[model samples]
Target: MNALRTLISLVFAALLIAVGAFPTGAAAQIGAKSEVHTEQVQARLLAWAPQGVATGAAASGAPGTVWVGLQITHQPGWHTYWKNSGDSGLPTELQWTLPPGVMAGDIAWPLPKKIPIANLANYGYEGTVLLPVPLIVTPEYKPGPLTEAMDIGLKASWLVCRQECIPQEGEFALRLPLRSSTALDGGAFEAALKSQPAELTGAQQVQVAGERLQVRISGLPEAVRGQALELFPETPNILLTAATRGDAPGPRSWTQRWDGAVWTADVPLSPDRADSPADLPLVLVTDDGQGWRADATVSGAWPAPAPVAAMSPALEAALAANAARGAAGGGPAVAPPAAPAAVPAGTFTWALLGALLGGMLLNLMPCVFPVLAIKVLGFARHGDDRRAHRISGLAYSAGVVLSFVALGALMLALRAAGEQLGWGFQLQSPLVVALLGTLFAVLGLNLAGVFEFGQFLPSGVATLQARHPVVDAGLSGVLAVAVASPCTAPFMGASLGLAVGLPAAQALALFAALGLGMALPYLAASWLPAVARALPKPGAWMDVFKKFMAFPMFGTAVWLLWVLGQQSGIDGAGALLALWVALALLLWALGLAGRTRWLIASVALAFGAFLAQAIGPAVLRGAEPAALQAQAAPAAGERWQPWSPERVQALLGQGQPVFVDFTAAWCVTCQYNKKTTLANGEVLAAMDAARVQTLRADWTRRDPVISAELQRLGRSGVPVYVLLAPGQAPKVFSEVLSAADVKDALAALKS
Candidate 1:
């Protein structure tokens, strides 16, 4: 989350704070629904791809007739969607009021495709599309050259998207010679339009005329649609709508049977139902198998009359004028509210304190517990290995402390650039996890007496190589802190929040303070030479202790397996098991022939191969969204997604704060704040009611979308409880929530 936040903040600053100064070349960055385009052509009210067409259209050069189309050009390994821009994205559309001597026509859609968006899937274009249209010039048309300097001037609107979406608009001008109907633009555009399947030339009704509910899909299958197809309705006023938008269940074939001779399309969705009225254009979008997309029309489909209620008071006031001009009509209306003032200083102070306390308490978390056991056990077993125990404990303690400073410093650097970071984030990265896994696995094998590390020359075990009293103890302190910190929690929230937001000097002081808190016990324990001296001399007990260390290490192995599972799934876990077996066998071989470095090297090679397979895909992602999201998300510490019940229980067990937000697509309020307030650093920090674990649930689609998640959260609608708990029952906020609202809830939870 921090990495993306850093980039986003940078981009946001360039766009909002310093216009046209973005270093990455996007001089024109706008809000989600807003776009600032400097391109050659302005888009239309809606740009129909193959599967779906926009709401309104102008008739072509023919009288009492019209046509619209979706043009597509696919790129290798990439494709643009037709009607159903599968998985996630808006389909093309166009809405217009016909000019005085013109009659409108329906779209001539091209084709469509199916795309996968990680956990979800969608159908759309991966390349480019040039949707065409035919407008009808009525007899009222004033013929020819002199009367018109330009052909037609129409307002265009549409949403263009890649991984993200941006709305576009422009004026489409087409001049026509009333007397001579020579092909315009050499008919190149027309020829391309003709290349499209005629079935999609624009028809709305598809019923057997006899069968009651028989299905009939008019569009033909193209390569872009792949071996299957999914239906998407353009508007309201149609029967059998749901049935049309779904993929055919069998092998590589689509069947739209006539349902007892009736034309039908699904009903339209609305924020307010009363506003729904007959007359809007109903476009049904469908996909071809591979790439191109085309949507003719599903008969009996039309958009509901505009919802006057969704308009603001000002816009609603225009309802009268709009009615005079035949604008959208309907009921109750509301205005978008204003945002509140900037956050207060006091809120920041508490957040910082929470981060601090959380960091201080992290030394005791179960995640770090195994590492500590080994640290403690190492010295106890080797406490007498040296002549005296004076420097042993201090050396180990030093290693732990130093490693922590390095981590703290790196996190601080990222936060300075406006990142939202959390503790134990390193473990979340596959590279780091795999490396740690390798480190621990080797250490475990060494402890099992396969070979021992001396830290320096002939060195293997970090504990064995410390040369001097101070350096050895200091290095040990550094190692302990490094190994232990990534797994601990509780006070981490406050600590991380403070480190990220405060001035560098203050942040370092706070971090050092937290480190001091962690090192305190060991510092004290190290000072007592008598305690170390009291331990039994090295013998079979030493072997037992060494073996004991392996168990914690074995635990580390298991933890790595879990992390691997998170990355590559069960297959990755399987490979890890194979690596383990190979390791075990090699270790056995080493016991029989300790001096055979080549044999051991081969085992190391096998482990390296295992790591390559586990982390290969993630490494190649570069700046892909999934990788970026992972970088940005603070590891839930031990929990995964917010929707998981197992994670909720784990957080509850720790008595930590759990912040969960139920959000959705249909809600404007949710979108507004998520884009503005919720993702902000201030909001993230204010969330320190207790050690906070943040979770987001995205609600986009209607049924399968909300259904699957709702079953998990045990909720029906969104804008629900954004539960925040410090150490108690979660404090819940209502649907129309805010940043301050969350802050206040967090404050209450802390109390």
Candidate 2:
């Protein structure tokens, strides 16, 4: 199945290139437009003429100006920053490579809206927006031919943000018609021009008094006289943009008042202010979205710049590299830092503590208990040997902590490179799921006494374990995390979410804390005198107990197989089970003596290999991702439909409440809720009474959309239940949910 998915992806990529469906930087000859589609944004270079201007003109005749704009359309819930991105974010940048005779003007940025993220506020645009630029053709330019086109090349980069920030870039080349003015997308261009903030023609004043930065405007448009207004500063880091409390929409962090003809606003100045410009440029917008720009004269001395937290060198380097990647061959210009959500003070410490507690609680979860049980049994065998027990425990803790840090680092690096991944990301890969299932199945067989290490191992090799008992304990810790981390036990989700937004050093510390928490209990059992004394003495019944433990191992294997079915469909799961059977048979045969054993093992190995190579591709070809199928054909009698941002918005627009279940097949906690509280009869009745829409965002497979939504809600993993009511903030449930939780949310919806 893994091979099949990889092959399909490769084939599609090749097909896109062969058919010219892939974006290219080559000059577009057919139309005066060059477009590129990044993962979350669709950007294009458009050429158009002013209204009433004739498109027909001699190629070598007159010098005229045409309008060219970089038009960007963001996916729902995503946005790109404006020139002055308040709080944090990088503005869109364009690097032009034009003909000697042609020149381009600065981007005519349209008025931006305040985008609040947690406590921080950013200035940006959502939906579709065009940044128009003027292209001037001077008399110094000589036309080569009557039919020749003006070649324009552009290299552009932008930082797009939803819950997280992604740095993206594209190269575009447009061949504008020299013989005639190109007026493509003229309506869009006209609308964009209208959206631009009109320059103020009235007197404006700016004065600083203590902590307040006051602005006064003498003349105001009658249309916006008594309405509430939003102020957008053109200068960065001059005013405080972080909200005082939550993300509830309201006026700015300061206050504003209207004195009939004159408008007055008093906003707090940022303590982190490092610049004091003579003229403070600002844009004021009314409730009706009309805007005017003003450059008010400075009237007072600026305060001292506050001491700020120093950014880690690694973070600084990464930002530098990201900026370099976009500006590679385009000159010395660099992009502004990609400002993700800032980590508030004490966030790291809180998250670390949460991660540790969550890790300790993980031992009680069904997915992890079996592994920990085996460790406990081993502790009993060690009995009174405190030194050996302590050594083994330390080794195991080291393994667990190191493994967690490694995984966290990888996740962070991948996210930095623009992969929308979260916790339990490994389980998203079919290959990893298959491998873990096989490992658990083999362990089950071994525990059940179907095969013994002594039968197959050379004498000296088998004794290696006795000489290095800690090696076995350490490996067990690695195995436990592989199967258990996907559970996302209580208190873990928020910590993991916070970790992603933190600096690398702090994030890794949180992961290590979680591992330490998970290992603390076992370490205490091994080292503490009273706890060690309480352990059961080894007896002849130990063999029987070991075999009994095999059942739990088998159960885990079965669960993994079921998860595989959810990802690769039934055919993939069936193939995997067949392979497991063959593996068991081969292991048994290897334990036997003589040529009969060799013959059986040889045949088993060959058969298993053949099944993997031949049947795997066929299974892949016949089956689609189970998540897609489940959405198309929901389970019998289920009221839930597949989730999408568009659907949620549409439902909310119609005055309906929404309940979204962010889940995945591998997430055991999510399944528990699904079969329990979410399915409770009383809960369903309440939901029906309230007409609450239920949408399931299945993360059985790698889904960027669901990932983004989870990030937006400040969660890094699944089992997230969000109840969104119109005109209210979304209410996110705890990791463990209950019938009462759903009922109460429904009750609130009704209220």
lDDT of 2 by residue, 628-706 (tens): 1112222334477767666677788799999998865434456557767888999999999999889887664445456
In angstroms, the error of model 1 at 577 is 4.6
Clashes of 1: 146
Model 2 lDDT, residue 187, Cα: 92
Give candidate 2 regions above 4 Å deviation.
Answer: 1-337, 340-345, 618-711, 714-751
Q: How far is candidate 2 from the true structure (C-alpha RMSD, Å)?
A: 22.4
Q: What is the C-alpha RMSD, rounded to one decimal, of candidate 1?
A: 19.8
How does model 1 fare in lDDT?
Answer: 0.45
Give the clashing pairs for model 2: none
lDDT of 1 at 634: 27
Candidate with top lDDT is 2
lDDT for each residue of candidate 1 in 512-544, tens digit (9 for 90 to 100): 666666765655665676656776665777678
